[model samples]
Target: MDTTMGASRRRGRLAAVATVVTAAAFTTALTGCGSVDKTLDCVQTADTIADSVTDLQQAVEDAAHDPGRADAALDSIETQLRRIGDKTDSTDVNQAVDDLDRAVGRVRTALRNGDRTPDVGPVTDAAGELTKVCTT
Candidate 1:
């Protein structure tokens, strides 16, 4: 009976060690693929910026017919850009956000003055640059 009990204790210890080793291996494997998380984050951020730009573009187009709606859209775009700028650590992304912010500011000014013909080229160009950085 003592011999059987000793063998059972050895088996239990071995199983515990195996469990610990497996857990460590799994953790290492996940840590090794940490870059996957970073890549996903970049893609998501890029998509968000792209969507904001699209919204801004649509708002600009609608401005000729509804300046009030366009002004509201511009405000939303500015808020989104500020959030993106605050969250991003990349210099390129920051610069792109800054460029977009400036372009949006210009549009807002034009809208305030009832220009109804604000240039959108700069905003489009800045958004494209931001997308490039996110994709690559």
Candidate 2:
């Protein structure tokens, strides 16, 4: 009877230890998952910004050739910048996006009015700034 009691107590202790270790491992795994998710979000945001910049560059070229294309490009750029701002947690990125959006709106308005002499310098500067922010 004494031997049986000792064995039973030992089993209980082993089980308790196992449960503790398992819980710890599970918690650690969850923490790691959170980190991975954050990293993925950042990568996705960067890709979005990169794609927007590429498209905007092409649009600028197209606008130079065909003013009519500027409206669509401006709309696309505004939408993309908004999305990028929404997804990112960075304040600098959000501010940059907002600045670019405003500049794009100005360019769009000028283009719509058939202004052949629309100043593109602001838009160009904003885009350059955004590109630099994204690349870093």
Candidate 3:
């Protein structure tokens, strides 16, 4: 009887410890690096990318003589897109990154054409598309 009681006590203690540990882990998962924070980061990154695209367009318009301005804007957009990709953790975000990449490519091509009145139509369209993707 004593042996049986001791075994029961050990089992009870083990079960309690397991329950506590599980609860702690669950709480940590819920509170640390949860979806809410990730979503906020996504929103912020998307906004940054949109703003960068706008800045790039403006720079292209105003500083056509300074290719460095275009380079800086592209760099900013690339960094923001990379951050969004890194933090996305979802298929939607992945698609958004892909879309942004295509948009950036379009913009680069438009800028490189070197026509004084080059068809900015494609660059503008791409930027608009990227903005929509980011917002979504």
Q: TM-score winner among the candidates?
A: 1
Candidate 2: worst-modelled 10 consecutive residues by lDDT = 13-22
lDDT of each: 0.60, 0.56, 0.57
Model 2: per-residue Cα lDDT over 1-136, one tens digit each: 4745644554454344334434444444465676445434433443444445444445555566866555665666677676667777767666777887888778777766876445555655565455445433
Clashes in each model (backbone N, CA, C under 3 Å)? 0, 0, 0
Candidate 3 C-alpha error for residue 62, in Å: 1.6
Tens digits of per-residue lDDT for model 3 on 80-110? 8788787766786677677767766766766
> How many steric clashes does model 1 contain?
0
Q: Compared to the true structure, candidate 1 yields what TM-score?
A: 0.63
**True-vs-predicted CA distance for residue 31, candidate 3, Å:** 12
Distance (Å) between predicted and true CA of 136, model 3?
A: 6.3
Off by over 4 Å in 1: 1-39
TM-scores of all predicted structures = 0.63, 0.53, 0.60
